[model samples]
Target: DQIILLKDGRIAETGHFEDLMAAGQTFCQLISEYAVTHRGQDGSGSSSGADSDNAETQSQDMVGSGTGGDTAAAGTTPTSRDTRAKDAKKDAKKDKKAGIIQAENILDGGLSASIFLRYLRAITYKYATLIMLFQVLMQVCYVGTSLWLKYWIGQNEDTSPESRPSLSLFLSVFSGLTLVYVLMGIVLFWVAFGVARIRASEYLHRIFMSRIMRLPPAFFDTTPLGRIINRVSSDFASIDDRIPWKLFEAIGHAVSLVASLTVVAFTTPLFLVASPFIALIYYYVQKHYQRASQAVKRICRATQSPIFQHFQETLAGVSTIRAMNLQGRFIATSAERSDLYSNSFIALAYGIRWMEILVQMVNVVITLLASLWFVLLPQGSVNAATAGLALSFAMSNSQSLIWFARTYSDLYVHMIAVERVQEYAELRTEAPLSTAPDSETGRALEHHWPQEGRI
Candidate 1:
């Protein structure tokens, strides 16, 4: 058995384990002290001890490598825990030197282009055509309900009671549309989110776990187990549990936005003249907002990796922490990690606030302009139906525009997690036959096969 000793974080002694133990050196002294202190037997040699002694012994057995658990193979020496830790760090550094995360991946294109579409392809490819047509039909029905309600209100204002539809007919029509809306939600929840999200998460988990298992040992050296778990577990949980609903809501809002704009332009054709200016402002504001928000969110996500890493480290070394009474230091480190993530989140919230203020101000101007145009103009110039429809959109125009921007931003942020999971999904693997050929293995075979086969 060999023993290597470290002092000032540098190796200070190297020799056979039996020689070190006989020398009564630091290595032997540490082992004896640690075992006795952990075992909690009265160092005073008194036999009378309280129940606390028994409790401490039980705790030590759970945590410590006692005599029963300390057996190393005959040819092996139990290296100091500190040496094992240092060796692990060295291996991780070696792996990092082999393959590093690039600046381009972090700063520019880490989030793949059209990430949401990627998820859609993963989850909905088989039924994509059917889903697309169904979504359009659903949106049309939704818009039609609004249109019908507007027309009915206009009819009540302008037409005689005798010319109007009976109360029962109006109630029946409204009730049917209401039922249709409920059914749309049910279908969206059960089929769109439930089936799709669960299946996608399951498939992603399978491939992700498979790749992880097949990865080279060096990969695990550099990457903490917690980080890997964070990616496929918490990160994917967001994609599975949250992204589907967010995507569904985003699609609904987008359809509503288009439908509202189109309805306003069609019924009051002059409204299209103002549409471009409002759209230009909305586009500029949203673009700036997302740029800032996504950057902060990226930082937030990066810092979060360390938080998970620290949590696992603390958990595994809890006994050491308690023995050294460094709980305060560990807790402070945890808080610091939390604050790092929270600071970025606060920055994101501030940017959102600024965007909301600008969006609301623009909305007020648009609202006033629309109100004055309808009010100052001759009464019969714009029909009651058109006026009602146009004004309704104008009243909530700010909210819809802001809602779209927020939802778009949220979708992008969520896709960062998807991109990360995808990165892991594409990580280099070990047992590969049908998958892409391993470059190193392929090159070696190509170089040596000719020489071996020439015989």
Candidate 2:
């Protein structure tokens, strides 16, 4: 068994692919034998000991031995060992039938933390700094717009209208800046998608498949088909998904958020007070929403498995159902299951809606408070001219802050997808048992490369 520790210094998982394979093979034989021997206790063979220790042990050991990590862990992983094992087998069989390496499997066997980080660094290093520059400029424009917007709105309020022109000017600049951001966003997506499809995922997939194909025979024998399939499918997806979204979104959002805040602080020091308070509220709300969402997601996933199982069962036994005229029953049952799934989602959405309502309430409260302060205040009552400018700036900045806060929750929600993809990308693969023969390697190289430039 190979036991690896997670970043948290806890044992991650333990298993040898070889052991899983042997267990699987043994399980199949045992199942067949049990089926043949099964009968009533009426002077005939029967499955008397089917659930006995000996038989039970064989079945349990088949799935449990390689899944020792899951058994030992304090909390259960999302997927069960048996489910994982089954999926792996299905994937392997699919691959064999297709006569091509599984893309999912290959994806799972990608780089580890150290290697993956290094790759990420190399990929982002060149563009990251440039992106930051653009981000700073965008932030400046945002602040400029915020100040002008406040002035514009304030000018329309009681007292003389002095800040109107400044507000209009700021609005024009802000709109232009926003258009630029949109254009940049489009360009970035184009480049990232092209690179990932052509170079990143494809290249990694190739290397991963090559390594997987060369893994020691024992590795295959001990590992569950589902776990392996998960690594290939889920893990690969993690990496692929991360490259375009998590990585990019994190970078883009962080820059924008910081820049927008910087403008707010510079324009109105008093406004800075709202930032931390709003952030804290957002954090508190996010923690609650995240927990609820996670629970909802787990339920959703659980419901999906049984639904899928029933789907397959129905398809496989369609003839029997038709003959028995039980198609309506199956349809009704499916509809019920689907309703359950929908309800689970609705519950989740309701939770999100409540959170959103709370967020909006906070924003409204903040806006009202700021407006009240600007309206009253006897002496320094923000001199009609500056008051308009100050209010416009404050509103814009506050709105921007609210926007940033909202994005954090949205980001948290989206991170589930990122983690799923990462899980697959971090899967481990065993090394090849045999190295290339030096003589054969040389001959193959000579035949292919033709180093002398011969035809």
Candidate 3:
């Protein structure tokens, strides 16, 4: 065995421990200082542990079940050996499952459209044909409502009595439209939310976790468990719980937008001429807002990782922190991290709110135009009913537009989570497990080269 010691990048000593001690005064003094520190720590730790043992005993006993059971057997149980065995096995199974990696988590490259499509396919590919057919039926019914309204209003116009709809006809038409709408809503909710969203979230989690398990140890070495946990738990929570609904509903609203635009174009022919300009404005606004919001959301997500990481580190080392009397320092650090995360979130929120204000102003303009044409021009048959119907569609579509934008943002952020998971999953793996000694230097490396100290 041999030892090589360095100071300031230059060799200070290279010898066995006894030889070093005989030759180096500084090394002996450093060793003595460490010994004193260790003794102090051991003495304080024993005394503090004595006070905590009784209070912490139950927790320790629970964790130690089916092991020696030295603490547990004293008070928790004596003959409940089978129960302990079952519990021990269950815990082991859980821990093992948590760490095990499946072969299914492989990913390709970056978050390209193909990757995004792959993700969507995992959620929706099975339902493609059915979903399309169902949505068509729903949109037809949704659009049909406006047509039905036009007919229903015709009853109020003065006409031949026989030509007018009878009481039964009116009731039947109203009931039919209501029934159709209710059915559309129910079916969309069940299929879009109940089936697709829930299953997609679960599959995403499986993929994310499987990938995490397969990641190299070096990935975890640099990343904090808290940050890792935040990505899987809270970020996944947002995607699983809300973002899917946002996406599904956004799609549903797109159908509504088409239907609304169709009605508006038919009732107010003038709007048809202006529709292209309106659409161009919408496209531009949506593109600009999406870019800005997505970028802000990414910033927020990045900032959130560190908050969780710092909090986890602090909690894990609280005892050591207290021993070192660094409570104020750690608390300040946690607060600083929290503040940084909050600034990003606050900025994101303000940006979305600003966009909302802009969208609402546009909606007001739409409503005003619809109303002003009906009031001022008094074009033939541009009655209150016609004006009101057009205005109502305008309002509905505006709300749908707002929600669609918000949902798009949600979708973007959630996809970022999947992308982050892929980041870990796609890390270049260490070469396949070695079966033979690596090289000539392996033998020397295996020996205890540092005879006196760690480098």
Candidate 4:
């Protein structure tokens, strides 16, 4: 009944095919060109005329009933294009309903204890305990080394030979403590930490894979492929490559900070007077920074999935897009998605820098307080050796504090990946592939139900 011809994204002709042909307009020109292109292969002018009549008749039938059978009988159906367009619209609606990718979740408050427990379970309690034990031993050796150095310095300053230890004895004890510290570090970092991280990675990955494989078809339908890819690729990359190191460094820095604080307190009791105030400052700074940083990181992570989803969509429709001359449009869309992710990432960077500046300022305050307390102390109340030890640890405390703050923040941020992986790992799986013979469905089947092996 009607023919609609589009030219330069606008309807150029709309009427009955016969009328459009009679008009000698855009539709007529297109038909003429198509006929000329097929004339050689079609071979007969009468056959071409028959094809044109069939096309017109099919178009009329399609306009009337919109059915496939009538169009199929015409031998060259244009209704497939309409069917495809309808399908595209339906998909667009579905995409709108389901969203291209589900938003990534950001957990509220501090990271729950369950996340840590889950990671520990992945590594197993035995390995976790062993790693902690090694860490404690390493810290003990480190403290012993510092104490021995202080003792050796005091002995050298003693004027009475009878009260002084020999240089050889000092050297032997110092070297032994240093060697033990190094050995403990090797065992903790190389053996314990490495094994634990590897086990956790393998276990989590296996669980994620198993659950994903057993997930129901509906899960995949609602969740975009790019979201799944992001989890398996970017999230797992953080778990496997980044989290372990951050966790190790965070633990190390925390332990070192504790040990240094202890040593400083032991050598200079006056420093303890300022400990509570310093701790309060640190707590507030960390709490404020962590809340902001975690939120920014979550946004950064969430925005990343759309970029992947958009890229996947673009690749999947590249051919159709090119045919429709939509390459520039797609490029612009890609840029928009990328910009969203980039903006979030930039915000995350700024948040990190803000945290770093605050942390460094706190460090400066600590160093300055320690130096003032030591210098203004009563004469002979603190020995030279003890004062020197406290000052040295105090000076080094800045690095330890900065690394502790940095690695601790990074550890929590990276744990978000593990949390995501754990979520997928615990998804409700579909029914088992095999059933027992005693079950109802299984019992109804014969041992050789299909004699010819056909369903």
Candidate 5:
């Protein structure tokens, strides 16, 4: 019906296709070029005139289909432009569905034994054994020093001076044990835990990096650079610093708790009757608190990744955002992410406070029971030294118990970083960097056979 052609941003020709063809100008030349380029597709070996007619009919059909208009009046098809628009829409939908930054994955249930084993393997069995041994030695010296104090008090109270140990000897032995205990603690923290943490961090980081480097490009397309950065920066920092300290403190507190309980039981035999019930209460409290604590910690950590992702994106697109005048929108979005993280952190703090109150109540109950037992006991049934030691340990148990639960929960929560690191470390990497040669010829090729410019 009508034909229009533009050249250099101005209309060059306008008429019916037949009239334009008859004119034998720009429109006709364009039709002839198209037909010649697609000659193989037509497969008829027709003259350019016939092919041009076929092309005109195809254009009419395409334009009519696209616009839902009369075929004769629709004009040119614009096939390439239409195809590109359709493709762009499809890509947009796909990208919206499969987001560039994936949500952080969280594992449910309690920390697995496998994760512990993985960490132990990373640190090596030798270092782990040494760490355990040093911890035990440190605890022994601590408990022994306390017991020696009880013994010294007993000797001072004795009416028979001949049986009493020399004061100089007692002081020297006590001082020597104190020195040994301090030395053991120093070594345990700086040497055993330090070296083990460093080694584990290095091993996990290396494998994680190796796997990431070998991963296919498609992985990066879907995974945000910020998510990767979060793993390497925040997660590894926790592993390097927070985790080691949490683990060491957890173990130390646990050992100290056991020692306190043992001393309490020894000095106060009747208290043993209620120890089981007290332990059961502590177990349930820790169990429920730990579950909520870990969940909140996961939420806290997950929200952190989004913040980091957003921050990185904002930094990268700062100029673009400024140009678009979208700084306020980005800042609002960042504030929202930070608020989410802050809310999770607040929940975690509430959980800790709840645990503290409950644990303190339990400790008070324990101390009250111990005091009642001592006051009610028959005269001379319990000696002053043993009773004083029991009271001191019972009082100290409050702090020890709370620290034990806190450190234990923290240790497991921090282990999440290890789990994540190990997940990447064990990921299915891309095919080997250098595969076996294809055949004899490939095997025989020289290492530097591909000389410069040979291809």
Candidate 6:
């Protein structure tokens, strides 16, 4: 803790706090005196000569302070005394420039990709297969229910000439199967929800915390606190809610769907033939959904910045707003941001709207075409039971495809959430090391220390 307040009036070196104080680190004390003397000239830079005079006075004050530490412990002379003075002068110049050079000056872009992958891999590895499984199961239930419903309705319409409409076997089976389908869906949803909560919290929270903590202070300087808080907290929370619900739908519906389609394919291959066009239509819709989702995600992130800025400004200047009577200006600015947000949302959803319409229209076409085939075919041109069953299958498949389309649409949104999480996780970082003279000096001695360099 020994110190030398050098002749040029900057810190020389120190070993410990008490030793430095005894050695007189009175730079602060002298600066305080200079400030007191120049109190009236604070705002006005005054004369350059006055500034020079202050520096000389401060150095003179340190003359006695250096002598105390110059007498070293035992019989040693300070080894790099000349180099130390030169370096101290250079250090002061760097400090003077430091304020003007922002944290961004030293930034390296290399950290971004590494950070993004760390978060992305964590979430995907945990949820990808589980989510896919859930979707498959959900589709199965959805398709099964629709086909069974169609079969029951068609059977009722084609009642035998000799019988009254009572206790038909088709009606009985449909009713029982539909009930089971609905009940199973409810249970699957609960299961999906439980699973999602368990996994969602694990990855989401850790990634969010790690990203925020690792980000440099410069990031916070430009980025609003509210926006960062919202991204890490509210946005991720929304993603959590949206993802699990979508996943549950995809699973429960997917299972019933495959089962229902299997029952129909058993009766006729024609039903499967009709489904591909519907699948094609669905594929188109899903592509559009992905495009829209990515667009929305970009817009949402852009919107957050300005909104956060305005929000912070309003919060910080509430008194100013009131005193200046500029509430109307603030209101107008807020409205402008709101309008921007609205337009961005509308633009993002435009593709989705068209896609949904096309999907629904294609579905209707599918159903109408199936009905035409059923009605126009001669009574025995195809087996009556088989044709009837195939028509039932076609109708169910169309409905199931619509559900699948919806699930895919939801999947696109969830992927946007995933992308956002990835973006946050991939933020750039730096590991600034202290450039203290002691630490720098030790590096050269590290390998040889206490061995060849001993006594």
lDDT score, candidate 4, position 80: 40
Compare the candidates by lDDT and give the number of the best one. 5
- State in Å the error of residue 351, model 4: 2.1
User: How would you encode candidate 6's per-residue C-alpha lDDT over 1-455 as one tens digit per residue?
Assistant: 34456656655654654354334445433332343234323423644444434433443353435543232221121233223334555665688877542321112112245433443354455455555654565555555555665555656657775663455666676677667656755665555566545566577767767777878888777666666665665567656777666655665456556765676656554557777876677677777676666566556655755676688889999999999999999999988987898788777667656666776787576557656666776776665555666666656665666676667566555545555566667788655333344664343334444675545
lDDT, candidate 2, 1-455, per-residue tens? 56332446655434564443343443233342342222111123323333232334444453455553222221222233333334545665677787532322212222245554534454455555555465555556555565555555565675466633555566677688677766766656665555532455665566667766766666665544544554455445645664445555555556665654454455455556776887788678767876676567445544544466568779889999999999999999999988998899898878767777776766565556556666666676455655555455445544444444445444444334334444434556564334455654332333345557665
Best by TM-score: 5
Residue 99 displacement (Å), model 1: 14
Worst 10 residues of 3 by lDDT: 101-110
In candidate 5, what are the lDDT values of residues 114-149, reduced to their tens digit?
999988888899888888888888889988988899
**Runs of candidate 1 exceeding 4 Å displacement:** 1-110, 126-132, 431-455
Least accurate 10 contiguous residues by lDDT in model 1: 68-77
Instruction: Please report how far candidate 4 places residue 51 from its true position, in Å.
Output: 36
Work out the TM-score per prediction: 0.69, 0.52, 0.67, 0.74, 0.77, 0.59
Off by over 4 Å in 6: 1-183, 252-282, 381-393, 396-399, 428-455
Ranking by TM-score: 5, 4, 1, 3, 6, 2
TM-score of 3: 0.67
lDDT of 3 by residue, 1-455 (tens): 56677789888777765554444344533443333333333344344334234323433343344332333223322223223434545665688877643222223332467547755775777654455556667877766776677667765665677777677877787678678878877876777778877777778777777767666897776556776787787677776776666666666667677777787777767676777777777777777767766666666777777777777778888899999999999889888878887887887788778767777777776666677667777466566567778888988877877877777766765676667665655666654433336554343333555677776
Alpha-carbon lDDT, every model? 0.69, 0.53, 0.64, 0.75, 0.79, 0.58
Q: Candidate 4, which segments miss by more than 4 Å at Cα?
A: 1-109, 160-164, 436-455
Question: Which of the two, 1 or 2, has more TM-score?
Answer: 1
lDDT value, residue 213 of candidate 4: 96
Question: What total of clashing residue pairs does each candidate reach?
Answer: 0, 32, 0, 1, 0, 27
